[model samples]
Target: MTEDIKVDKVVDLKGMPCPMPIVKVSKGIKDVEVGQVIEAITTDPGALADFPAWAKTSGNEILKTDQQEGLIKFYIERKA
Candidate 1:
């Protein structure tokens, strides 16, 4: 189940490809406070796996992930 999170920032990478979405998400996460959440919207299919792996290695927390139509949304909380 996904948590009802309050996102502090939204990084829209909807027409972008693989690495770009991850890159934007990485940068966007820094824009929020340490405990704040950042919502990353991407159309890249690779993001489904990339995000969770990246969040784990980067020490961040992914609160939720939802995929609808062609868009994927990741709610990531900055933990480091």
Candidate 2:
């Protein structure tokens, strides 16, 4: 399901640590228009939990989450 999501923006936060991943995602999401999707690629383990929580609080919609090896990918759609 996540594999089919089309992303308008890609934020590569690989190698970055906690908060920073979400921080970059937060900043990157602003570049995309509402209803557009943003894909954040991060190596931080915490992102698995943080992205969903952040999306919930920020009103963004999380379309998908994929974790492969140590990499985490989040497909987020800006709701506002």
Candidate 3:
């Protein structure tokens, strides 16, 4: 895990499933500035694998991710 960055909002996707977390995080990050971070908290097991791929495909940056207490937290930065 990397150091936590200063993020504008923390999206809690704990109960959400699959692409929902990814979709919500994608939408939420759009309004943020370039280099600004957003923290996504999700319990969706697939996010561990999906998000990083999405970030890469979308040209965003997944700065860090950590699994804690069965939840996954991803710190993502908008590239544009």
Candidate 4:
């Protein structure tokens, strides 16, 4: 679960649309150490697809994801 993941950095993408959400998450990943988890919090529905694509292309691992109400949380571990 996301609650058990130790987050090294958190990026809030609330209200951001499309590419911005993924753009910010891409940048956020760089701020963390490899193997450290970065938590991305977003309200954008597009993040549902963006996050997974990012994890695949970047070779990082998505440790967990939680969604409720309108908020989405992604716990990603840096691999690169």
Poorest 10 consecutive residues by lDDT, candidate 4: 1-10
Question: Candidate 1 at residue 35, lDDT?
Answer: 98
Q: Across residues 1-80, which tens digit of lDDT does each residue of candidate 2 receive?
A: 87688889999999997779888989999999999999999999877788889999999999988889988888999999
For all candidates in order, the CA lDDT equals 0.89, 0.90, 0.88, 0.88
Clashes of each: 0, 0, 0, 0
After the best TM-score superposition of candidate 2, give how far the Cα of residue 61 lies from its true spot, in angstroms: 0.9
Over 1-80, each residue of candidate 3 has an lDDT whose tens digit, in order, gives 35547878788898997779988988989878988889999999999899989999999998888889999999998997
Between candidates 1 and 2, the one scoring higher on lDDT is 2
- Looking at model 2, the pairs that clash are none
- Residues 1-80, model 1: lDDT tens digits: 55568888999999997789988888998898899999899999988889889998999999988989999898889999
TM-score of each: 0.93, 0.93, 0.91, 0.93
Span of 10 residues, lowest total lDDT, candidate 3: 1-10
Question: Model 4, 18-49: lDDT tens per residue?
Answer: 88988998899999888899888999988888
- Model 3 residue 74 CA deviation in Å: 0.3
Clashing pairs in 1: none
Query: Which parts of model 1 have CA positions greater than 4 angstroms off?
Result: 1-3
Question: What's the residue-level lDDT of 11 in candidate 2?
Answer: 96
